[model samples]
Target: MAEIKTLAATVRSGTGKGAARSVRREGNIPGVIYGGGEAPTPITLNYREINKLIYAGHFLTTIFELDIDGKKERAIPRDYQLDVVRDTPMHVDFLRLKAGSRIKVAVPVHFLNQDVAPGIKRGGTVNIVLHAVDMLVPADNIPEAITIDLSTLDFNDTVHIKSIELAPNCTPVDKSNFTIVTIAPPPGGAAEAKRAPGKLCSAQAAESRHMLSS
Candidate 1:
C-alpha cells in the first residue's frame, strides 16, 4: 500500500472560470469536491504540492487526507484536466469518501520478474495489453498498484485480468475475460518466421512485399 502525503487547501469563495484562472495565476490549482451526498466545495491547492503527488505515479489510488479550511477529509482524485500544449494540470476533481465506502478507480499495473521470465530468456517479447484496470475497492484499502508475476510466463503464455491476484476487498470492474500481458516471439526472428507461412523474415518485410504486389 502506498500512502500519499496530505496537503492543506483553502476554500475558494469565488466561482466561475475567471476565478479559476486567477487562482492558477497565483500558482494554485482550482479543484472541486463532490459525492457522498454533499454539496460540491470549490477549493484551491498548492500547484507544487499537487505536482509532487502526480510525480509519485499513484495519485488516484493513493489515499489523500485533504485539509480543507482546517477540516480534514478523505478523498480520491476522480479526474484532472491538463493543458494540451503545456501538459500541466489545469483543473482537478476529487470525490469525497466515507469510511467503508466502495469506490471504483483505475489502478496501475506493474510487471514483476521480467528478466527472470522464461519467455524473455527464449528471445520472446512481452506485450502489455493493459496498463491499468478499474477496480471497486474499499476507500481505505485501495492498492496503489496491482503487480503481476511474470516469473512463470513462457513463450505463447498469457496472463489475463482474471488470473491476477488482487488485494483484499478489491474486485476488477471488467467482468469480461481479457489478456493483460502475453509472451510472444519477437516481431522479426526465426521463431516468428517459422510461425507464419511463406517464411517471411519480419512482419514489416511481409507488409512491404504485399504492398508491392498489389
Candidate 2:
C-alpha cells in the first residue's frame, strides 16, 4: 500500500507567468490539482518541502494527502516541471485519487535470493530485462515494489512475467508474458572464441602451433 504523506499548499490568487515567477521567488513551487470529480485548483507549495520529496525518490508512485486551507484531498503526483539550469522543481500537477480507484503505475521489481541461486554461485550472470513492471493496482493498496525469487534459478534459466506472483487486486498491464530476468552462463563458456578444438588466447595459440611444429 502506498504511504500517504501529508503536504500543505495554498490556493493561488493570481495566474500568469509573472505570478508563477513571483511564487518561485517566494520559495514555493506552483502547481495544480485536477481530476477526481472536482474543478481544477491552482496552488503553491514551499520549495524546500517539494524539493525534499522530489529528491527522496518514488514521489510519483506514492500517494499524498494535500491540505489546502484546511481541506484535505487524496492525490498522486501526475506531472512536474524542473528548472533547466538549476534542476529544481519548477511546477507540479497532482491527480486526485478516489476510493477503490485503480491506477496504472510502474512498480519497481526487486530480485531476491541471488546468493542462493545455484547458477550465480557458479559465476553465472543475472541479467535483468525489465527492472520495473507497469501494473494496475488499487490506489489504496499500491505496493512499494514487486519481489521475484531467484533462489532456485539455475544457469540459463529464464524468468517470465506470468510466473511472477502479484498482490491481490494488482495485475501486470502487459497482456503477454514477457521476459523479466535470466541467469546466463558466463561469457566464453567452455568454448574458444577463435579456435574450435581448444580454448586459447593469441599467445596460447602461437604456443600450440610451435609445439606442433617441434
Candidate 3:
C-alpha cells in the first residue's frame, strides 16, 4: 500500500497571479484541492517542505493527509507546475480522496527472483520496457508497486501485461496487452553456452572410458 504522509497547509486568503506571486514572495507555494464532491479550496504550503517532497520521487502517486487549519483532508497529488527556468515548484493541484473512490496512478514496477531466472543464469540481460504502469485502484489501498516474477523466464522470453497477476481491485489503465520485459540473449549467445557444456561433458566421459579400457 502507498504510504500516507501528513502535510501542514493553511487557507490562502487570495487567488490570482498576483496572489500566487505574493505567496512565493512569502516563501510559500500556492495550491488547490478539488474533487471528491467538495468545493475547491485554495491553500498554501511551505515552499521548502513542498520542494523537498517533489524531489523525493513518486510525489504524484503518494497520498497526503493535508492539515488545513486543524482540519484533515485526504488527497493525492494530481499535478504540479515548475518554473521552466529555475525548475522550482510554482503551483500544485491535489485530488481529494473519498471512501471507496478509485484513482489512476502510475505505480512503479519491481522485479523479483532475478538470480533464479534461467535467462539470468545464462548471462542474459533483463530489458525493462516499462518502469511504471498506470493502474486504477482503490484510494485507500493504493499499491506501492507492480511486481513481476522472473523465476520462470528464459533466454529470449518475454513478459507481457496479461501474464502478470495484479493486486485485488487493481486494474491496469492500458487495455491492450503490452510487452513489459524481455530476457535478451548475451552478445556471444546464451543458446550456444547452454548447448556446449553437455557436449563437452560427453566427450570427456568417452575419453575417460577409452583410457580405462586400454
Candidate 4:
C-alpha cells in the first residue's frame, strides 16, 4: 500500500495571478484543492517543504493529507507547474480522495533476481520498455511500486502486461497488450555460440565419412 504523508498548508482567500505572485514572493506556493463535491479551496504551502517533496519523486501518485487551517483533507498532488529557470515549483493542483475511491495512477516498476535470469547470465540486456504502468487502485490501497521477477526470463524473452502480478482489486488502465521488458542477445551472438559445437561436430563427421568413402 502507498504510504500517506501530511503536508502543512494555510487558507489563501485571495485568487488570480497577482495573488499567486504575492504568495510566492512571501516564500510560499499557491495551490488549489478541487473535487470531492466540495467547493474548490485556494491555499498555500511552505515553499521549502513542498520543494523537498517534489524533488523526492513520486509526488503525483503519493497520497497526502493536507492540513489546511487545522482542517485535514485527504488528497493527492494531481498536477503541478515548475519554474523552468530555477527548477522550483510554481503552482500545484490537489485532488481530494475519499475512502474506496478508485483512481488511475502510474506505479513505478522494480525488477528483482536479475542475477539469476538466464538472459542476464548469457550476457544479454534487459530492455525495460515501461518504467511505470497506470493502474486503477482504491484510494486506500495505492501501491508504492510494482514488482517484476526476472529469474524466469530467457534470451529474447519478453514480459507482457498479462504476465504482471497485480492485485485482485487493481486493474490496469492500458487496454492493449504491452511489453514491460525484453531480453536481447549479446553483440557476439549467444545463439550462434550455443550452436557452434553442434555445427563443428556435424562437419567433422561429414568430413570423416567423405575420407572413408574416398
Candidate 5:
C-alpha cells in the first residue's frame, strides 16, 4: 500500500483563471477536491511543498490526508496540470475516498533474477511489453508493484498476465491474458534489430495488442 501523507491547504475565496493566477502570485498552487458525495472544494497549497511532492514520483497514486482550514479529508490525486515551458504545477484535482472504495491505478512492473536467466546468459534480450499494468484495488490495499520472476525463462520464452500472482483482492483492469515480456533470441536469429535483440519491435507489440482484442 502506498503511504498516506498529510498536506495542509487553505480554502480559496473564488474560482476561475483570475483567481488561480492570484493564488500563484501568492506562492501557492490552486487545487480542488471532489467526489465521495460532496461538492467540489476549492483550495490552495504551498507552491514549494507541492512542487517537491510532484517531482518525488508516485504523487498520483499516493493517498493524502488534506487539511483544509483545519478540516481534514482523505483523498487521492486524480489529475494535475503542469506548465508547458516552466514545468511547474498549475492545478491539481483530488478525488475523495470512501471506505472500501476501489480505484483503478497503473502499478509498475518489476522483474527479478535477470542475471541468472538462461536466455539472458545465452545473449537473449529482455523485451518488455508492459511497463505497468492497470488494476482495480482497494483504496488502502494497493501494492507497490507487480513482480515477475525471470529465472526459469529461456530464449523465446514469454511471460503472460495470467502467470502472475497478484496481491489479494487486486484485479487487472484487462480481462484477457496478454504477454508481459519476451526473451528474444540473440542476433542472427529471426526478427533481428540494430538495437538489443530482446528490444521489442513494432510487430511484437502489435501482436500483444491483438491478443487483448481477441
Candidate 6:
C-alpha cells in the first residue's frame, strides 16, 4: 500500500463567491473537511498539490495524511467542484475518516488480457458495461483498482459481479449477478451487410424509426 501525504493548510476568515474567486486567483483551492461526528472545518489547499493528486487519479480511495499546522488528520476525497469552461478544479470536499468504519467508494476497474481474449480473435468486440464498481471497503484497505482477466471469454459471454474475486475487506455494493463486461459480435457486421445501401431492412428500419420516435 502506498501512503500519500499532503501538507496541511491553515484557513483564514473568508466568505462568499468573491473570496473564493480571489483564492483561486492566488493559486489556491477552497475546500472543507467534514464528517466523523465533527463540525465541518473550512480549509484551503494549494492548487499545485491538489492538481498533482487529481491527475494521478489518487483521490478516489487513497488516504492522505494531512499535516495542518503540526496537527495531523486522515481524509478521503468526497466531492469536487470544477470550473466547467476551463475544466479545472474549483473546490474540493474531503471527508475525515475513522478506523474500522466502512466507506463507500467507486474503484477503477482494469481489463487485462483483452488482446488475447478468444472473442477478440473471433471478430467480436468487447463492450464495457461498467468501467468501475461501487464497493464498501475499510478505509485503510482500499484497493487502487480491480483487475479483471478476460483471456478465456468467448463471444456473447459476460463477466458479472458475482464472478469477481475481491481482495480482503473489499465488498462490491451491487447485487452479485450484476454484469460488468460482455463480449459481443461487432455492431452492424452482418446486419449492415443485409440492409440495402440507402434503404433499411424491415427490422432495422423499424428499430431506427422507433429510436427516433423515442
Best by lDDT: 3
Clashing pairs in 6: 8-67
The collision pairs in model 2 are none
Where's the lowest-lDDT run of ten residues in candidate 6? 188-197
The TM-score of predicted model 2 comes to 0.86
- For TM-score, the strongest prediction is 4
Candidate ranking under TM-score, highest first, comes to 4, 3, 2, 5, 1, 6
**Comparison by TM-score, 2 against 5, better one:** 2
TM-score of each: 0.84, 0.86, 0.86, 0.88, 0.84, 0.81
Q: What C-alpha lDDT do the candidate models reach, one value each?
A: 0.85, 0.88, 0.93, 0.89, 0.90, 0.81
Instruction: Itemize residue pairs with steric clashes in candidate 5.
Output: none
Q: Per-residue lDDT of 1-214 in model 4, one digit per residue for the tens?
A: 8889999899998999999999999999999999888999999999998899999999998898999999999998889999999999999999899887898889898999988998888788889999999989898788888899999888889988887778768888987788999888888787654554445566788998999999
Model 2 is weakest, by summed lDDT over 10 consecutive residues, at 189-198
TM-score between candidate 1 and the true structure: 0.84
lDDT of 3 by residue, 1-214 (tens): 8999999999998999999999999999999999999899999999999999999999998999999999999999999999999999999999999989999999999999988998888889899999999999998889989899999999889998899888889999999999999999889797565775546566788998999999
* Local accuracy of candidate 6 as per-residue lDDT tens digits, 28-135: 998888888888877878998887778777576778877766768888888888788977889988888788888898988899998998778767888999988999
Tens digits of per-residue lDDT for model 1, 31-91: 9988888999999989988877777677777777899988988888998887899878888
What does candidate 3 score on TM?
A: 0.86
84-192 per-residue lDDT for model 5 (tens digits) = 9999999999988888889898888999998898888777889999999999989877788899999999888999999999999999999999999999888766334
Clash list (residue pairs), candidate 3:
none
Candidate number with the higher lDDT (2 or 6): 2
- Measured on C-alpha atoms, candidate 4 has an lDDT of 0.89
Worst 10 residues of 4 by lDDT: 191-200
